[model samples]
Target: MTSDQYIIQRKVNIVELGATLGNISDACRKLGVSRQHYYDIKQALIEDGIEGLLEKSRRSPRIGNRVAPEIEQRVLDYALEFPTHGQTRVANELKRKGVILSAGGIRSIWLRHSIEKKSLRLKRLERWAAENTNVLTEAQVQALETAKEEKEAHGEIETHHPGFLLGQDTYYVGYIKGVGKIYQQTGIDTFSNVGFAKLYNDKTALTAADFLNDKVLPFFDGFGLSLLRTLTDRGTEYCGKPENHPYQLFMHLNDIEHTKTKVRHPQTNGCTEKLNQTIQEEFYAVSFRKTLYTSLEQLQTDLDAFMDRYNRERTNQGRHCRGRTPMETFIDGIELYQKLVHKGELMH
Candidate 1:
């Protein structure tokens, strides 16, 4: 039964129990409900019968908590105008138009109207245009056509072992007093949360290749593992016509397949993006001001120490890992995959 129906039935049971036990106070105490609440239920039953025990919606019709109708309409119009924009961008656009809305509030409206994804929204608009072609303006039809033609890309990569897939990306870690400008190149194992990061004075194709060779490859090699693939964005540092990109050349030499994210879709490389955010909040933001680094070597030294703690000490609460550290999860995944292979249930 629905929760509301269950609650109504429970109230009726409580009233009956009070009558049977010959004590309203005893029934209220046993049911953990206030005596006043028991009386209210009993009175409702006396006046309106069983229908009165049915729970009504608590939502207020004229409540100020609900989004204003005009504001919601403006949000819908803005979303239609920019079909490719995510909730954050939509909320920012509304803010610029003097319609302040939190991302959660905007998402709630989108969910209420079933505008979950850009592609879904575009499809709805296309249907509307098809149905009202005679009434739609020229500009409205053109907007619908453009949205329909836009490609909708969604992808997810699964890793069965630690070296099955790796996601790499670079982030600007800000300029330090003595270190000048710093750029951090990071790589994370998709199956395990194990990550490696190196700070460079500049972000270039050569630096990106060096980070993979000097840090990422060597770390995996120490564990007697080989990376199957590396995923990155189409930044100049990691992409080109393939022959000229140093990072691409490095991957080719190592026998690792290099995969780039879809154009304008950074969520495809979300693993490294999430790692960058974690490092920014947990490491750089907390330690950058507190620690004094006189040279690049010093910063690199501290960064290496932090990476050790991140891999071996910090317990990951991810769904796959539970409370195990990244190293522990990596080892567990390898063991499970090996057992499955031995049982002839999985191919190597």
Candidate 2:
């Protein structure tokens, strides 16, 4: 029988006995139920009729002590502050800063704030990087062949300076947890072969543009004193979706021209292409160790620190550098650049 039916029957038996037989204990014994159970049924029947004996409301008590909005915002703020970091990493950071919370709680805060899992972007980038990898167009093939022929005829390929020419490409460091091991968009200065990278979660026109505006452009205007050219591949990062790809607009605004390497032959942009691979070997490989990163913000911080050290302190084997760091070379080049400027030969 339903609990409500059973409760009603028991209460009826108790009442019938109390009125006719005058003993609730005797009535409960006759009904094969305890005295306490009978009394409980009696109370429920009087207060709630049949419904009280049924399941009561299962809702939880209102959590007036829920996490504060500002606390959750703090979690999001810290996560953005360290882009390469994941929710778990952010949780640790919060803990380190003495914010007492469970990892799951911190993750919930991230979710509530619409902070997506970093791995999602990494996976998308990995797929795109794989799809576009080494698949050169017919035009690119012909260009490679032409460049090879010219090199054979002249012994050295004609190249140009930073703003005059930039070479763009991608490099890989093993699989990342969220994003598989795919290509990270990279660039090099044709003049000095100095390198930089835009570690994309995936390549979108806007992401590429943002990378250029927020990261690459600043580097050019600052550290790369002689930058006058930007070389790139005709990848979507540069060409397709002009509305989203800010590099085109940026180049137009600065009055700088972007040159693309021959379609299939990255060797035409060999300087930056080579440096992309070198960065994979010299920095990413060492730092990432082929494991998935927990956070992009953390990774960016590490990359920035490494780059600064590389430019200011690390010794290079290239003849152009004479074992000096890129920063040291840049400092020396300033004097030469001023001389060229005085002679009306060089322009910023």
lDDT top scorer = 1
In candidate 2, position 332 carries an lDDT of 63
Evaluated at residue 154, the lDDT of candidate 1 is 37
Off by over 4 Å in 1: 1-156, 337-348
Give the CA lDDT, 0 to 100, for residue 3 in model 1.
Answer: 76
Poorest 10 consecutive residues by lDDT, candidate 1 = 143-152
Q: What is the lDDT of residue 10 in candidate 1?
A: 98
What TM-score does candidate 2 get on C-alpha atoms?
0.48
Note the Cα lDDT for every prediction shown: 0.75, 0.57
lDDT, candidate 2, 1-348, per-residue tens: 976678556567676776676887777777787888777767887898767666456486345655877787676666543434555545655765678777788777656545566543233333433465533334322322232111211112344334344566544433344443334666655454455665666665556556656666787678455346666667766775444457677666666666666676656666665565455434553343222346666666777776665566555545456655656665665666666768888744
On the 0 to 100 scale, the lDDT of residue 108 in model 1 is: 83
Model 1 over residues 1-348: C-alpha lDDT tens digits? 987789888999999899999999998999999999998998998999888988766764546677989988988876664454568656755665688999898888888789978667665655554575434444433322332121222345667777878899878776655567778899998888899999999999999999988988888788766777888888889887668888888888888898888888887877778777666644653344234456778878888988897888665655566667788998887777666557865422
What's model 2's overall lDDT? Answer: 0.57
